[model samples]
Target: MSQNWKFFKESVRHFWQVGSLVQSSRYLVDSLLADVDFAESRLIVEFGAGNGCVTRELLRRMRPDARLFSFELSQVFHEEISSIAARDPRLTAVHGCAMLAAQMFAAQSVDCVVSGLPMGNFGKCAKLGVLSTVHAVLKPGGHFSQFQYSLLDYRLMKRHFPAVRLGYTPLNFPPAFVYNCVSA
Candidate 1:
């Protein structure tokens, strides 16, 4: 099946969660990952692995022994990404919510977290839970990158991460705001 079709179908079925009708573009991916140091990262987590665009990029840059766990709440998206994960030993696909990150990974165990989750769509409590889980799993100096079409979650991100750097990319389907954050 064509990847684009899959994205369209999933987006129609889960618009509020998926956020877009297509996968992220290279420009948006690059912008979101501008500050990630993949060379030294060993344990990484991806919040939403919709069609594996960013997952492929992360795998390309990550070391041979590095492990990447990708979470997707939509069963369809999970199945799609799981197929991609099957081809790479370093990648693991989890069909669950990002809020379970703290339960899945030990405190300060993750080197980085790249999120495709729509934080702006989440309620305040859900937002706080997910952000807190991200903070709990990330190492003291680790990074978390999240991209959204709006700055609706800017203050929410700042509340959890001590340092937050914002970047914009107009090349995507809808211009995106990339937040590069560091855990204190």
Candidate 2:
């Protein structure tokens, strides 16, 4: 199945987890990753990597020696990422939760985190848990980029990161607001 079809199917069956019925547009993907300096980044983590859309772009832009660990909660999407991983040695497809990031990697070891998680659908505690995990795993000056359909999590993101920059891409299916946060 095509990536879009797979994403739509998963979103229909698991809206709370999958978040969107459509894959991210190139504009949104670019906007979300604009702040990441791929050349300087060594270890990158991607959360909620749906259908490997952003994963593919990240791989394309990253340094050859850099590593990406993509975490997906959905089995179907994880399989798709795993297939991509098979071809790219720098990619590691992890079928798990983003909250487990700290446990999977050393503290302050990740250079960047690009997340497509539907934080708008998560409860307060769950959002805090995931954000805390991102902060914990990120290096002192690491970047954390996430896209949301609304600005609901803007304040929450600011609370977690020392600095937060917002950008918007109206070309996406539902449009998206990108939050590029810098870890302290």
RMSD (Å) per prediction? 1.0, 0.7
Q: Model 1: runs farther than 4 Å from truth?
A: none
TM-score of each: 0.97, 0.98
Return the top candidate by lDDT: 2
Model 1 deviation from native, Cα RMSD in Å: 1.0
- On the 0 to 100 scale, the lDDT of residue 148 in model 1 is 91
lDDT of 1: 0.91
Tens digit of lDDT per residue, candidate 1, span 6-95? 899989998998989889999999987889888889999999888889999999989999999999999988888899888998999999
1-184: candidate 2 lDDT, tens digit per residue? 7878878999999998888889999999999999999989999999999999899999999999999999999999999999999999999999999888989999999999999999999999999999889978999989999999999999998888889999999999999999999999
Worst 10 residues of 2 by lDDT: 1-10
RMSD of 2: 0.7
